[model samples]
Target: MLIGDVARRSGVSARMLRHYDALGLVRPTGRSHAGYREYSSKDIQRIFHIESLRSLGLSLREVRRALEDPSFTPAELVADLIRQTRERIAAETELLTRLRRIDAVEPSGWEDVFQIVALLQALGSKSAGKRQSAALSSVDDVPLPVEALVEAALSESDPNVAGALRWALAQSGEESLALLAEGLGSPAAEVRARAVQSIAEMPNDGATTLLREALTTPDLVVRRHAALALGVRGVADAVPTLIDMVVEGTNDVDAADALSALATRPASAKRIATKLADRLAEDGVEPPARRRLTQALADIPGPTASKALTDLSHDEDREVALTATYILGLRAAR
Candidate 1:
């Protein structure tokens, strides 16, 4: 076919097609009698593959390398692409987090803030993680000061303050975990919720029991945190209980946490996904729930989970539409 035909079919401009040819990214299958380039169906397939990789965040150079070598497996190329995309996402998340902290700082103390800003500028040349760690370490270790900060964090109604405290505590390791768990037993519901999250980060028997007990706590926030903690733990034992909570419970927060936790166990996740698909077939489950279940299936990595998610992606529900797309991307990466 002519360049126009390839451009129309591939949604890539004619100029790009010629540029790709120049870069040897995609060459014609043959040449016409008049020496014009002739692209066959196979060429179009290559174009489509390139387009897909580009959409997934691969640069032209990276895509060209993958295409040049026939020995390069699709799985390997997709894995590299996914790794790059994840790194980009992590960097962007960290930048956004820093911006949020900067925005929260008061503007009244201009002189001191400006001096600190200049110092930060010098430190910013280092890695973000390193800079953050250095800044935290520079603070005085007086117990009263730390306690006051913790108290302020606990009393503050803002989620952002809670999140910042969580992040800071997470970086402190065991001490942070101990502090958060202690906070959970405090009078403030917000403090308890934050503590539950910190407990979830601790992958020990003590943390597990704490989470389990929190599930039965009187406070809704505590119960919700327990469910979240269980999910993050990815413990197989929690799966059945979470499933029961989903099926028999009326609390949306609990149900959401159960679903999140259920998605972490590979074995139980597959079982639950299959059960959800069966329920969908029977027309007994709600569309939103079915879609959430489908997404949960996709989130659990492995061939069995991928196959289940792929099947559910074709479900009539629009909510599950992206689940299939994500599952396919993961499968491709695998």
Candidate 2:
């Protein structure tokens, strides 16, 4: 076949075939009596091989080395191609996510797009200060999509930056709640904890609903945080988990405070006192946890709490007895 026929038949353009010829990658195996370049069947076969390699993202040089080098191994080259392809895919995915976030915000012009892009870059910054600043400024100008704030809040490790991110997410109200719900179900314990903490900052009904759901989650961290949030909202369902937090010594003080807040109501105060008394009655209650429980009852009002306090004042453990005595005196003086 002549070069024209080979180009037409193989789908390799004539210019590309000439370039392959110049590079000695594929040369015409024969010449016609008319003096034009001519290719034998084997030469056309080589052109097909080069095209096949290029389709796998092989550079022309790599293709030449692949076809001509006797000792060339494809395993390493194929692995490298796979790695490169994965990197390219990751970059494209990140770009697409950013574009979608920007579009979701409904940017009014190029300036809004540029501002949002800058803010997003800052949110992902290596510097904690920069990230915190970005989070604080997120609501000032172009409203960033809640998804970005939720993403940042879930992964943030620094305490100050995490607080800022959580605050930013709270400002978005219910918008951040759905995204945070996904984080609550994440397999990573840290992510689930962060999700709960962020949700705890939002005071809306949607956030309250998520916290109620989080109370049922198996993660103790999630359950504790959700209970605390629920307690402040006057949701009595959090009462049991809040009591558990006190016994477990995880954020026990905050849990106690939440319980006290709920105890301000007449019926809730009586019910809370009964629950505390029940824990005291449990067979395996330890001195430390028992003492903590006694202290928790100090802030709760009503005759049930006073009776529970009165019984604890004469307990066998000196610390529990003293704590209960001190609380009784404080309640009596009031």
Candidate 3:
């Protein structure tokens, strides 16, 4: 076959075949009497081999080494190719995500696109201050897609940046609730906790509903955060988990404060008091936990709480008795 015929059949252009010949990658095996290049069957086979290697992202130099070097080992080269491919794929995926986020914003012009891109880059910047500034400024001009805010909120490790991201997500109202709800089911414990915390900042009813659903999650951190948010919203359903938080010593102070907030309601105050008293009466209740439970009851009004405190004032544990007595005195002073 001549060069043109080989180019036509093998899909390698004639120009590339000549370039390959110049590089000694593939040379025609013979010449015609007219001095034109001619390819033998084996030469065509070598061209096919070069094309095959190139398909696997091999550079021309690597392809030359692979085809001609007797000492070359394929294992290391193949592993390197795999690593490079992975990196390319990761870069492409990040680009696709950013493009989708930009598209979701419905940018009005090139200027809007540029602004959104700048904000996104800042959100991922290495400096915590930059990330926080980006989060705070997200809603200033171009409205960033709620998905971006939720993703940032979930992955942010810096406390200030995380708080800013959560605040930004809250400003998106109920739009971010769905993504944050999915975050609640993440296999990562930290992600679930972040999800709950972000949801806590959202003031809409949809966020409240999700927070209520999170009350029974198996993640202790998620449940505690959800319960505290619900307590802030005056949701009576948070009372049980808030009590559990007091017993477990996980954010027990905030849990007690939430319980106090809930107890301000006449309808739920007695119920909250009864639940705390019951926890204090449990057989294996530790002294520290029991003390926390007693302190929690101090803020709760209604006769049930008073009667529980009066009974606790004479308890066998000295600390518990003194705490109950001090609370009773405070109540008397009131």
Candidate 4:
């Protein structure tokens, strides 16, 4: 078959066919004696596969790699491609839903928009899977109906629509929690941090467990966010972990946040102050470690911490003395 026949069967233009051939991605099966290109049925089949993969959102490079590597299973490649597409679609759908919800309301349309707003709020509270399904169910084909409802509400100036948008923004679900758990494995540290933060907002034993597990992450950002989340959740179970972070974590911000969280309880405050005082009194404690311990003690803000800081005011390190003095001043104010 000629290039025209390949184009017709593959639904790709002749020019793109030549481009694919030039890239060595779907070469012709044979050549005529006159030096013309010749494609066999096998070549057409290859083109179809390439097109199918492209439709599924694989880049040409990814397609080429999957095609050229014999060890790469087609099913695995397709599955990965599908997952990527789903993530993209999910993000897009969320953005569209927000936009539509904003546009759906009218001021003069109804005396009370509370019912519609409540429904939208309930919809938003559902898991992402449920939300996605609800959005899709409202439309014939496109996934924009939820957004359309929002848009209608916004346009009509309905108070219910405004309430719905706020509710959705605050919505939490198991699916969202699962998405966050999956993000913990992302290569980006920021993504992992955000995932942990989101999970902390929702009330779930599983979510808390995931946040606790994140405390052990090698990434300081992830560990920092986990500590902050644990504090926000006010989980007493996390106090020990947060204390460890204050004692040993590389990130000062994280340590500060953890110490602040731990300071909320008198028992925790006393415990942390005692630990810091012991560290300061140790002959073998390094200067830097000692300094960090002093800073954490000062941050705890109590009689025990203030007393420890006052004693440290006479230390050899001028910075430590100054910090201790500052802590004394802060404690005096209280």
Model 2 lDDT tens row, 8-59: 9999999999999999999899889998789998999999999999999999
Q: What TM-score would each prediction reach against the true structure?
A: 0.40, 0.95, 0.93, 0.45
lDDT value for model 4: 0.66
How well is each residue in 1-334 modelled by candidate 1, as lDDT tens digits? 9888888878999999999899888899998898888899989899999898888777899788777778878898788877988999999997675454444443346664554444344334344443444335424231112332344345544455445444544444454444455777898776787667656656666778778877777776676557756765665445544544444443534554555556655666666666545554565666666655565455555556666667766767766767677768876886
- Over 37-153, each residue of candidate 4 has an lDDT whose tens digit, in order, gives 799988988998899878878889988988888888888887887798899999999867654554453323343244344445545543544444443333222222234333322
Ranking by TM-score: 2, 3, 4, 1
Report lDDT (CA) for all predictions: 0.62, 0.92, 0.92, 0.66
Candidate 1 regions off by >4 Å?
1-150, 171-188, 201-209, 218-220, 237-269, 272-284, 302-334
Global local distance difference test of model 3: 0.92
**How high a TM-score does candidate 3 get?**
0.93
Against the hidden true structure, what lDDT does model 1 obtain? 0.62
* Model 2 lDDT at residue 84: 97
Per-candidate RMSD vs. true structure? 26.1, 1.5, 1.8, 14.5
**Candidate 2 positional error at 228, Å:** 0.9
Error of 3 at 279 (Å): 1.6
How far residue 63's Cα lies from its native spot in candidate 3, in Å, is 1.6
Q: Judged by lDDT relative to the true structure, which candidate is superior, 1 or 3?
A: 3
Give the runs in model 3 whose Cα sits over 4 Å from its true position.
none
The total number of steric clashes, by the backbone 3 Å criterion, in model 1 comes to 1
